[model samples]
Target: MKFTDGFWLSRPGLTPRYAVEVDDIRVDERAGTMTVYASTTRIEHRGDTLNRALLTVTYSAPAEGVIRVRVQHHSGAVPVVPAFALAADPGFGPGIHVDDEQGILDAGGLSVRVHRTGGWQVDFERDGAPVTHSLARSVAHISGGEGTWMHEQLALGPGERIYGLGERFGALIKNGQTVDSWNADGGTSSEQSYKSIPFYLSSRGYGVLVDSPDHVSFEVGSEVNTRVQFSVPGETLDYHVIAGPTPKDVLRRYTGLTGRPARVPAWSFGLWLTTSFTASYDEGSVTEFIDGMAARDLPLSVFHFDCFWMREYQWTDFEWDPRTFPDPEGQLARLHDRGLRVSAWINPYIAQRSRLFDEARERGYLLRRTDGGVWQWDLWQAGMGIVDFTNPEAAEWYVAHLERLMAQGVDTFKTDFGERIPHEGVVWHDGSDPARMHNYYPFLYNEAVFRALERRYGVGEAVVFARSATVGSQQFPVHWGGDSDSTYLSMAESLRGGLSLALSGFGYWSHDIGGFEGTPDAGLFKRWLAFGLLSSHSRLHGSSSLRVPWAFDEEAVDITRQFTRLKMRLMPYLLGAAEQAHAEGIPMMRPMVLEFPDDRSGFDADAQYMLGDALLVAPVLSADGAVEYYLPEGEWTSLLDGSVQEGRRWVVESHDYDSIPARVRPGTVLPWGAVDDRPEYDWADGVTLRCFQLPDGYDAETTVPGADGTATAFRVRREGARIIASSSDARAAWSLQAGSATATADGAGTLTITIEDNR
Candidate 1:
């Protein structure tokens, strides 16, 4: 991907055709496009244009505040499918003007100008100020023995940092990192990502999304030292530069272009206790775990069946293993009777021993090679053939099995193992290029299952605990951090991945509570319990052992109970956050940078995050519970205890399993739910408005999500030393709390509580 050895020398044996100068520029007003023909070599004399290639650079506006730039070497190359799905505004028309000096195109406060007499220069500006631009020799058509590549380099400003390449576990800042858009089943603590998004968000209030599903290599300040270079092996390179005055603005525009995360059900937010991969898959074992949680007063919501639910060496057949699960329908009914949802593990690969494999092979529902043979692999199963979701019949065939499971009362599915898609020696049913289908495969795989769930249930009620994701996979509800080992280090790494995914436009994210591949100690499990319960979604799962909290110690089970109940108590606030995610495309769990863009330390802080816009959650990464976090200048109050910590600096403290470094932002009217046993409840009824340091003359109105997916209005204001809270809905009761002072209203009334100053 790095063509130049340094700044001055090209990599040996690689042929580079740099776009030196623009020969002509053309504009089509109807299409809102500007095409610039740049000569590969500088035009000196009449003979200088004889035997030279020209690079065509096209500029257009997809939506407001978004500009698409496509650099092409050959215009006649065949088009490729399986690209990222973008929903461009149909009636958008950018203001185009070309003078003697430059050509300008403006769309919604963002503009791009192409210098007429410069050495192939294009400058992007916001509000008539410079953001980033392409300099001389930055656009090139690269060729070597590997293949042809279309390359583009954009300059990085001083002190500008990069973030978001999807589920990365390294440093939060992405400077000096070489990343590729290849999805792999790499565990936590590696450069390889399970969900690899071909996008990078700049701290300078902008983002760039490479519009390619094929392998894209990015050299971020690693090769050029001053610019981010990306290359794709093809004739054309298409990308979009989304303008943002803020990082949140950038994500809003980007997710609008791609799809936004769907609204999930309320029960999906509660604690999900799974039969870990090593647990017995019989009904007795399932009942024992479910009964154990209830006996210990641990609030359980969902019970998941892992891979052992199916017969060995057979997957994608969607049949319950008869030896263990003799009555799938009856078992699901029993779990539902206990007020618990059910999720099952599934993937798109069909093993040879699967009952549907031969039918799929005969019906062309599996990917075929160029030699007209089924492409088989033996990594996770015995001779598994990936289902060809590209074929309409194949997708229908695949969803038929899901419909059968839904009839058996499965509420959701864990779509796993999509990162192992083959990129070579394969042909898709729809004639999509194989390389492009590699990352795009997960999109199709998750979409088919998600749509099936939507059809069975309604929209906003379907859920999938998917592991692999692509650029547009955020439309699905939930995605989890994949394959983490059992350790404090892996716990921190999992947090890093979740934070990265939040920046990459995902709304809801979850991870294994006790880690995925190993058994954790009692302390680690208790620590992860606090972190997991605070997440947007919570689940207890492991690889080779049962993940029941009692498996660790009594303290572990107690910790599980306290945190799970705490999350349930916090449901009103969390459900409101989920509504923001569904409406604005913002994530429920946000990175610190998204909350505090002006704070320099926030860009580098990955150890903590803001749960919604109110509370900051710093998971205990050390066994001793020592955690250090940053807070801007404000009055910070702990959500766990009524203790307060002053902000504007670093604070380190040790907490027990009953507590965490969770603090509420100042002047926040946080909604505390009434029920602590189940997540689904009438939120407005019996709610408590916990006012945290309500500043003088503060007024804000917010909504609490209702059970039927509607929002109820709540208003709060601080006048003098009295803080008043009121709601219009007369069907429920509410309360107010300010600095140890508490008052309750019966139904549909106002609660006024006067705070004592320094009493």
Candidate 2:
């Protein structure tokens, strides 16, 4: 994708045709668009335009504060790929200001100015202040031995940092990186990502998303020091410029364009134990693991059966391997009887040995080659045929089996392995371009399964542990970091990936507790247990080893019990954060920069993140458990202990296996539940409202969601020396904790107390 040999020279065998000047402009008042025809050379006379291809660029707005620019070199090449599955928004075209030199089209607060003379440059301004610009030569159509490519480069400002190229793990700041927007199954160590979103937000309060599902390459300040360049392998290039003064605002608009994540169930916030992949596990093994967890007082809410649930070479058969699980219905019923929701592993693949494969091949439910034969691969399984999600009947045929499994007590599915979709010489049922459908395959696959679950179980009750994703796949809740090694480095990389994904508008993310590739040591397992339990979703899974807490050590079991109970007790606060994510598209697990954008320390603090708006969680990733995390200006208090630490500097601390650096931010009223073992309960009953240093003029409030789909609001404020606490229900017996003092709420649903030395 790199066409330049140096700053001033093009590469060999490359002919770059730059859009020098705008030749003509046609304004469409009805469509609210401005179309420009830019020729490679200045159109001086009638003979100057002979034998030349002019680029046609259209400027339009899909929503307020969003500007979409579509550039095409050849207009007759019809694209079979579907548009990157985005939600439509009919924007109120703000106004159009035209002059002799330039035309400024204002949409919401963002303005795109098209230069009518001199160099062909498009300048983007947010609220009349210059943010970024596409210089004359920055927009080009290149033709070479590598074929045709359309490229665009946006000016990068000083100290501008880029983030969110989909769950990336390399670095927090994407300044000197080369990222490709392609989905791959590479683990946490590589540049390849499971979720390669074609969007990125900058520190300068603007974001750009290349609206191409095909392979796109980005050189972030690498090829050129002052611009972020992206190229696609086609004659047409399209991108959207989103303006936000704040990082959260950018994500809000981005998710509005795509879709917001669905609200996950309350029970999904609890611990999940999975059958390790490739491990010899039968119903007895699963039962023993459950029994062991119960005996150790470890709280588990969901149990997942991995790929072996189906027989070998029959992945999408959807039938339990009767040799191991005789009476699968009875087995699931017994697990449900023990108050546990069940999940089974499924992928969008059907091996040829299975009966479903024969039916699908006959019904045209599988992806086919150009010669009319079904596409088959032997990577994950023998003769695996991918289900063509482009066809409606194919999706229905696939989901019908999932519905049957759910009817037999399955709660959710771990939709894995959409990254291995074929792109070369393939045909989609709906005639979508194979190259574009490669990365978008997961979106359709997960959507079909998610919608099926919602139809069966109702809203807020469906969840998928998906792995691969593209731009809009964040609508599916609970995507986990893919295959990782059982090492400290992998844990840190997993954190980086999750933090990046959170910024990319995914509300909930999880990772394998003790890694997924190999068995972790006892110390590593115990440490990862704490980190996993604190995530928005927690799961214990591995590739070749058992992920049961007792599989590591007795201390591991104790640590699992401790952190699992802590997360359960913190559900009142976590569920509220989830509700916020559903309403406004901010993530439950947030990067520190999202909360404190102006703080330089928070911008590079990838080791730690804010659990919500109120609590800071720094997972200790070192073998020695030594962590150095920064906190913004505040008076933070440890949720583990009542000890306080003044912020605005880095805090170096060492934690044991039982604890992490979890501190409550100032001006927070965190709600804690009484029941520590079970995740689903009346969250308002026996709830304790822990009021952290609520600076005198500020008020803190939280809503605790209960099992019956109702929530109670608890409010606390500090006025001078007296702290006032109020609840929505007068009969709710809740405790109020301010510093070291704890008092039960009075009968009037309000409690007033005076601190000795109120800040």
Candidate 3:
């Protein structure tokens, strides 16, 4: 995708054409838009402008603070126009002004100044301060022998860092990196990503989303030292410039344009145990693992069956392999009787070895080759044919298979491997261009299965462990960082990827607890166990070895048990945050910058994150169990030892296997369910509300979500030495306990107490 050899000339077999001069600048005040026409060929006279080639740039506002710029040459339209469309409020119309003398047209905060007979530049600003600018010869419509590309260069300021290219694992800062917005199954070690979104936010408080489902290549300060350049293969390129005063605001505006993530169930927040991929397992193996965890007092909620549950070369048949799982229905009944939910692995690909493949082939439900035959590839499975999600019947067929599994006691699906879609010499059922279908395939595939589950179970109960996603795939509840090696370095990278994805509008994310590629050492496993249990979704999975706690060491089991129970006891607090995620477009797991935008220490603090604006989690990333985390301006209290740590300073600490670094911010009313062993229960029953470091005159409120997603709010305030608690819903009962201080409410539905001491 790199065009230039060095800086002076294009590489071999490449031709570069750039827009040089603006021949004409026309502003239509009535329509509130402007158009600048620039030609690669110089305009000699008025007669020469008739058929001469020109790059037409049009600027318009789709929303109050959103500006869309489209550059085009030919009139031919793209084959597959994506389903993404901007939704905006019409009441706040854009403010447009045109200065003919200065050749500047300003639309809201975006301004474009074109030198009438000289070079053209477009600058986007907020409060008259430049965020990014496109200089002369930066916008180009290039044509090689058989390919056409449109390129643009945006200015990058010093000390500015770019982030959020969709589930990237490389670095927290994307400077000096070349990224491609193409989905690939390259695992977590390489630059390729499973969910590649063409959106990036800069620390300079601005973001750009290239509005294309097709492949987009970005050279972030790499191709040019101080410029972020992106190009796509087409005659036209459309992008949006979103303005924000902070990084979090940029994400709010971005998710407002793209879809926000759906809120997952509260039970999904607990620790999940999976039958590791390719591990030898049967009902006996599963029962032993479950019983072992129970014996160790480790709280486990959801148990997942990996791909081996199905017969070899017959993945996604949606049937439990009779050879190993002879009585899957009864086994699942037994697990449920023991109070556990079940999740099974599934994908959209139908292998030819599967019994349903012939039926699909005969019914024309699979993707077809140019000669009207089914397209088959022998990558993950033998003669696998991808289910054509573009076909309604194919989607129905896929859902029918999942429905059968659901009927057999499957609660959710580990939907995997939609990234390896074929784009060459293939035809879609809806006649969509194959090139665009490569990235969009995951959206339709996950949506089909998710909708089926939602139809069976009501809303707020359906969830999927999805891997690949596109622009709008945030509609799915949970996705995990894919295929990581078992190491400390890989664990840090996985956190980076999750933080990046959360910034991209995903509310919940997960990863393999002990890493997905290899058998982790005991130290790594214990550390990863703590990190995974604290995430929005937790699962223990691996490639070669079993991920049971005892498989690593005895200390691993202890660490896993401690964190699992801690997460289960914290469900009341976490689910309230989940409700907020559904209401607003915020994430349950937030980067430090999202919550503390004014704190300069938070801009690069990827090592720690705020779990829903209250509890801060800093995972032990090294074998020594040493951690250095920052606490913003607050009187933070440790969740483990109940010790207080002052804010606005760095704290260095060492932890054992039984504890990790977790703290609650000041004035936080964290609701805890009475039951510490199970995640899903009457969250409102016997809720023990804990108040942490309530400052004088500070007020806090907590909401407990019912099974139906309705919440009951409880408000509490501190005045001088007295504390008052009240609830709008009188039927709800609550208790307060912080450290040694405990207060119980009478039947009057309000509690009043005077603190004897600041214990």
Candidate 4:
């Protein structure tokens, strides 16, 4: 994607056309836009523009402090489906100031100046200070042997760092990296990513998101040290620049433009066990594992059936394997009787021998080649044809099979493998451009299944364990990191991927507890058990080996039981955090920079993360259980024990398999539940308000989620010698820890307790 040889030379074969002089400018008051026509050759006189091509640049204000720019070489190419959602317009438009030498368009707090006499310079500013700009020869329409491309480059300020180009595992900071926005099946050790989002946030208080589903290549300080260049292989390049006084504001506005994350069900917050992929399993084996967990006092919530649940080579048929899973309905009923949900794995490809293949071929539900034959490949399965989600009947036909599984009592699905879509000489049913649908295929595929689930279950009860996603796919509830190996290194890499995805606006994320490729030893399994239970969603899965706790060691089973019960106890605090994420577009698990933006070290800290803006979780990554973490200036208390650690410095410590680094922030009123055996219960019935060490005049509030999907809220504040708790609902009970307190309540459901303050 890089075209320039150096600072002053172009590549040998590529021809570039630069917009030199503005020939004309038109303003559309009705559309709230400005259009400029610029010629490739400079026009010193009227005769100088005799024979040349002209480029068109259009600008509009999408929202307050946000500008959308579209550059076009040909004006006739209209994309079928744009990736991100469009912004809603306010009543008033921006202010425009034009002069002979320049023109300025002011939208809220952001301003862009278009030079009329310079070669090709556009400067962006905030309050009359330069933020970033495109200099001479920075905007070019490029052409090579294969096709044409539209390219744009913007200057990067000193000390500015880039973050969030999707679920990347290489480095948290994206400077000096060449990234392509294309989904792939690459594992955690490579540069390829399963979820490739065309958005990035800079530390310089701005964010840029390209509104294209075609392959976008970003050279972030790689080709040019002082510039970030992005190019797409097409006639038009459309993107938006979002301004922010803070990073959280930029994320909120960006997610508002795309879509906010949805709230998943409460039972999904507990520990989930899965039948290992590629391992042979029958009803007996599954029942034995479920019974073993119950016998050992491990709290289980969801049980997942992997790919082998269906017959081999017939992925999309949606029929359970008769030989292995002959009694799926009865088995699912038995599981539901035990208060556990069920999940099954599915993909978008149908094999040649599947029973529905001939019917789909006749009904035109499969993608066709240029010669009007069904496109087939043998990559993952023998002669597999991809279902065309762009077609309405095709999506309906695919969802009908899922409906059959729901009838059999399957609660959810693991929507996997939408990253390997085809684009070479293929045709879509809706006549959409195939090049663009390659990266956007997962959005359509996942949306079809998600809508089907929502139709069957009610609004807040639908959820999916999806693997691949694109721009607006956050509307679906949960996604997991794909294909990690069994090692300490892979565990850390998975955490890096989850942190990166959370920064990219995903609310809930999970990964395989003991990795996905091989069997983990007892040490790795116990360490991963603690980390997995602390995640937004927890699952135990592997590729060719069993992931049961007892398969490793006795201590592994104890660790699993211990952390699973701990997570069940922490559901009130976690569920309230999920509601905050759904409402504000922030994530439940946040990077250190998102919490403390002023600290420079926070920008680079990826080894630890903040869970729900209150507790800091640092997973043990070393085989010897060594961990080092940093905390901001505050009074910190351990949630595991009553031990306290001072803030504003780094501390190195070692832990056993029974514990992790979970610390609550100062002045936090954390909520806990009395029920420790199940994730689904009436949380407000016996809620315990575990108040951490609080300063005077400190106030905090949280919501308690119930088993029937209703929420009750409470507020607490500390005043000198007593803490006051107020709630309209009287279902909550208190367990005061910050003080030795005796409770006294008024008739209006308000209770005041005297603090012992033994510390």
Give the Cα lDDT of each candidate.
0.90, 0.89, 0.83, 0.85
Q: How many residue pairs clash in all the candidates, one count each?
A: 0, 0, 0, 1
Models ranked on lDDT: 1, 2, 4, 3
lDDT of 3 by residue, 1-759 (tens): 678877788878876667877776677766666788887766678787675578888777766557778888775875454445556555544555545433554546555555555566677878778888887657887778789999888989988888888999988778999999999999888888999988888888888989888889999999888889999888888898888778767777777877777767666887789999988999899999999989988888899999999999897577788888999999999998988889999888889889999999999999999899999989999999999998899899889888888888999999999998888999998998788889889999999988898999878789999999988788887899999999998999899999988877788889999899979999889999889989988999998799999988888888887888888878888886776666666788988877887787777888889898899999999899899989999778888899888899888999887778899998888888877887887777677778787778978777887765576677788888877777766555568776677776632277766775333
Prediction 4 global C-alpha lDDT:
0.85
| Over 4 Å off, model 4 | 21-24, 39-41, 90-92, 117-119, 127-130, 706-710, 739-748, 753-759
Model 2: lowest-lDDT 10 consecutive positions: 85-94
How large is the C-alpha RMSD of every model relative to the true structure?
Answer: 1.1, 1.4, 2.6, 2.1
RMSD of 1: 1.1
TM-score for candidate 1: 0.99
> Which residue pairs does candidate 4 place in steric collision?
740-756
List TM-score per model, in order.
0.99, 0.98, 0.94, 0.96
User: Which regions of candidate 3 are displaced past 4 Å?
Assistant: 5-9, 26-32, 41-52, 82-93, 102-118, 746-748, 752-759
Task: Encode model 2's per-residue lDDT on 1-759: one tens digit a residue.
Answer: 588988899999999999899887888889988888899988889999999889998888888999989998997887667668666586467567667888878888898999998988989999889889998678899998948999999999988889998999889788989999999999999999999999999888888989988999999999988999999988899999998988888999999998899998888998999998998899999999999989988889999999999999898799999999998999999999999999999999999999888899999999999999999988988998999999999998899999999989999999998997889979999999899999999999999999999999998889999999998898888899999999999999999999999888899999999999988999999888888988999999999889988777788988988889999899888888898788788999999888888887779898889998998999989889898999889889899987788999999999988889999998888899988998888888889888888888767666777677766787788898778888767646898878777788643388877786532
Estimate candidate 4's RMSD in Å: 2.1
Give the better candidate number (2 or 3) by TM-score.
Answer: 2
Q: Which ranges of candidate 1 are over 4 A from the true structure? A: none
Model 1: per-residue lDDT, tens digit, 1-759? 789877788899888999998888899998999888899988889799998889999899999999999999999977889889899999888888887778888877688899889688899999999888888878999988878999999999999999998899988888999999899998997889999999989899999999998999999988887899999998899999998899899999999999999999989999998888865658888999999999999999999999989998998689888888999999899999999999999999999999999999999999998899999989998999999999999999999999999999999999988998888889999999988899999999999999999999999899999999899999987999999999999999999999888889999999999899889999999999999999999999999898998889999988998999999999999988998888888899998889889988667888999999999999999988899999877879998887888898889999988889999998898999999999999988888888998888998996887886567787999898898888888777888888788898888878888887511
